[model samples]
Target: MAINILLTDTSSPLGIGLRNKFESTTFRFVAEHPAELSWRDESQVREYLAEVKPHLVLNTIGWGEGTAIKPDLLADGAECLGRCLAGSSASVLHLSSYRIFHGEGKVSHTEADVPKAASDLSKAFAQAESAILGALPSSLVLRSSWVLSTEGGSLLARLLADFEAGRSTVISEHWRGTPVMVSDVVRAVYAVTQQIIYGANNWGVMHFGSSDVCSESVFAHKIQDMVQAETGRLLQLEAIETETDNSAVLEVRRLRDCFGLQPRSWRQGLRPAVRRWLDRRGLLAEVDSAVVEND
Candidate 1:
């Protein structure tokens, strides 16, 4: 029997990536957009779940990937979903962000550390996680940092847009983070879901990201270098120092030990991600054939 998977939002990049990942598999994928139903209303959520009868629910409605859902609303929606799934056989996987930690140290934040919640957004994320875990203790909350995607309002998308428009790509020199490709996230989700389906009781907060870390400027320069090497277009890259400490690093030992998943370098996905972005905009025609073949 195919496992029925219900996706909360199919429009987000993560949702799209998940769809692409599981489409050819035996898992049956179904989705409900935020506009179709009121996520804050528990009754509506219950009705929808009962109608779908999904064995697994993937909650992708959150702050990142250019989602318009507000932070407070996200918390409310999660609360409703958790309540609806309580006492049921269904399992949930909530996607969360690592921005909840506001520490300045170089050490990666672990699942054991409490969220600092320095900003309103972070506070809402913490509240959402609390609501989900409080209602469904067996649920999984996967938090990631610096998710890079070719679609939507991701950081890489914005930088690529700037480079395409012949504008200087200004990046921060102080901010540091571990970038994880959306495809990697989808792979993690599939691996974890398979475990859960097979009766693995590992549930709660887990972090996943690239094994390496770098400053915003360095990551941008890498993208710049790829574009230049592939298309022979030199983009102006500028680094600016910022007083605000926006560094976010996630410790992946918990996820690695639990799922036996090893982290891969973010550079491994750089070329393909850039190629997809450029190909979407009809810019890949200018790319060198040799470089494309090598990539």
Candidate 2:
């Protein structure tokens, strides 16, 4: 029997990528749009859960850009969903960000470290995690940083747009993060979900991302280099020093030890991610021709 999975927030990049990932799998996927669902209302959530009867719930409610929902509302929705799922057999895999921790120096944050909510967004994320775990102790909260994809308003998409429009890309030198491709995130999600389906009791928090970390400027320059190499177009990149230096690097040892999942460098996915971004905009052919001509 195929495991029924309910995926919330189907409009986000992570949601889109996850849907694509599960298309060929044995899991039966059901998508729920964020606009259609009210997370804060317990009765509504309970009715939806009873209707869907999902064996696994992938809650990705407010992890995207341009989300109109307030932070408190998002947290409330998570708590409500958790409470609703408390007596049910369905397992939850919630998405979170590494922004919950304010990294000190080069230290990678472990799951044992307390999440330092430095900003409002981080505070909301922490609260959501607590609410879900408190409501459902078996729930898994996966924290990642710098999620990049070809679709939506991801950092990679914005950089590609800036380069295509001949706009100078401004990057901060002080901000550092571990960039992970959305596809890799999907891989981790699938692996963990499958383990859960197989009756593995490992739950709570896990951090997953690329092994290496770099500043925003370095990441932007790497993207610029790949674009220039492929399409023979180099856009001006301006690196500005910021007053605050914040690093969000996640320690992935727990994910590896628990799930036996290995981390891949974000650089490994950069070229293909860039190519996909170009292909989406109908510019891949031009890039291919440019490369061929140069050869």
Q: Against the true structure, whose lDDT is highest?
A: 1
Model 1 deviation from native, Cα RMSD in Å: 2.5
lDDT of 1 by residue, 217-279 (tens): 888888888887766788688878776767677879888888888988889878978987776
Residue 236 of model 2 has an lDDT of 73
Cα-based RMSD of the predictions, in order? Answer: 2.5, 2.9
TM-score of every model versus the real structure: 0.91, 0.90
Query: Model 2: per-residue lDDT, tens digit, 130-160?
Result: 9778877678999987888766766677788
lDDT of 1 at 140: 88
Collision pairs in model 1? none
Best by TM-score: 1
